[model samples]
Target chain A: MTSSDLQEQLNIKALNLLQGDADKIEKLIEIQMENLDTRYCPLYEEVLDTQVYGFSKEVDFAIRAGLVSEPVGKQLISNLERNLSVLYEAMNNKTQAAE
Target chain B: MTSSDLQEQLNIKALNLLQGDADKIEKLIEIQMENLDTRYCPLYEEVLDTQVYGFSKEVDFAIRAGLVSEPVGKQLISNLERNLSVLYEAMNNKTQAAE
Candidate 1:
């Protein structure tokens, strides 16, 4: 393979790994969303926040290391954040309903 | 550059970027250690923990993405953790002395 081909392969691999991590976080959100009726778990929020923070760091490193472009990295993070916000909004609604 | 050359370059870049991040965290520890005589600040601990967590994530990603070797990535994290532990021990001693 040529240098460009190798670079392309590496970029794709990096993006896939990041997407997989995002999916794990998304699954966490989905689980919490499904269990909205259960008592609100602060620990879940902390874990989610920590996961997101770690993910952003990974994306940032990928960009800095040239494994991923800045635009692509940022988009991945924003997409995850949007989904997270939806989860938070649902949680808030559930809490208000309980109150 | 050849494919192998490109790969080697990326590996070095990834390691350097991780080291740079580790240095930043080390600086944070140094700053906190210098101010140990001042009243203890829980915020510093929180920030340090968060930074270390993020750094570890970056190192993990680098390892997964095939940019850095697992041993090298883990060593970078352990070195930072050691310094962080030293800072925490100093803080604990200071607190005990004050009491």
Candidate 2:
């Protein structure tokens, strides 16, 4: 799946986990804010489109939409792997070069 | 970051996006089930500990727990990259071997 797709999947997984206990929902959003500042958080949150205080919608779409027929797009995950591999090799090469 | 940490982070991001719309929540869970069967989904669902219909707690904790002081633990996302890289190499190697 594309990173965007993986992202959506991850988002879906997160919301499926929250289940509106209010307390837990509150806690989860708090962490989300840590990564996404208030300005950014709302923009992402807008995906779900509830004036509700917690849970982001874009993330949920993956789950609601039945994304599981596919875990992540094969190519997207593959590209992520390739990018990482390059990063890993570069880091290793740099270290060896320095050594 | 560890896959688990990334898992948590993904979960957090997911919840932060949902913000409690019941219809969205329902759709989200349904998609979630596509990936996680009902029995598994609920078990994961219980992570949030809400009698509520949607959202999983384990996923939400990443968002709520102030986990951002760190993002997916660098090593985790990196490892995900590594594993994927190996798969990439192995697939290529097999194709080359076949040729």
Candidate 3:
């Protein structure tokens, strides 16, 4: 394969792996969103924060390594952050209702 | 550049980036080691743990994306962990001395 082909292949693989991780975080957010009626567990917030932190590190490394472009990395992270924000908003509403 | 050349260059870049991050964490450990006389800051421990966790995620991503070999990734993590353990041991000794 040509050099470009190899580069493209690597980029695709990197994006896919990153997306998979992001999906895991998204799944976590979705679970919390669905269980909004249940009492909020503080540990869940910590776990989600840690997961997102780790994932951002991964994306940063990928971008630095030339495996993924900056824009693509930003897109992946923003997608997850948007979902996380939504989950947090729902949790907040539940807390306010309880009060 | 040839495909092989590109691959080699990417591998080196990834390794260098990972080593740079490891060095930052190592610097943190060394600082805490030198300040053993000062009261231990629990915050330092928390920061170190979070940094290591994030760094591990980066190494994992690099390995998964095929930028670095599994052995190389493992070596990077183990080196940091070993230093962290040494720092912890010294901290333990200091605490015992104070008691």
The CA lDDT of each predicted structure is 0.93, 0.40, 0.91
The candidate that achieves the highest TM-score relative to the unseen native structure: 1
Q: For residues B1-99, could you state the per-residue lDDT of candidate 1 as single tens digits?
A: 999999999999999999999999999999999888875687999899999999999999999999999999999999999999999999988878988
Listed per prediction, chain B TM-scores read 0.96, 0.32, 0.94
lDDT of 1 at A2: 95
Q: Interface RMSD in Å per candidate, to 1 decimal?
A: 0.4, 9.0, 0.5
Instruction: Score residue A95 of candidate 3 by CA lDDT.
Output: 83
Interface RMSD of 2: 9.0
| Best model number under DockQ | 1
Instruction: Report the Cα lDDT for residue B25, model 3.
Output: 96
DockQ of 2: 0.03
Query: Each candidate's chain A: what TM-score?
Result: 0.94, 0.32, 0.94
Interface RMSD of 1: 0.4
lDDT string for model 1 (A15-85, tens) is 99999999999999999988888756868877998999999999999999998999999999998899889
Candidate 2 ranges beyond 4 A from true positions = A1-58, A61-99, B1-65
Q: How close is candidate 3 to the true structure, as a TM-score?
A: 0.95
Query: What are the candidates' individual DockQ scores?
Result: 0.95, 0.03, 0.91
Candidate order, TM-score descending: 1, 3, 2
lDDT tens per residue, model 2, A48-77: 222232233222334443332234433333
lDDT of 3 at B19: 96
Q: What's model 3's interface RMSD, roughly to a tenth of an angstrom?
A: 0.5
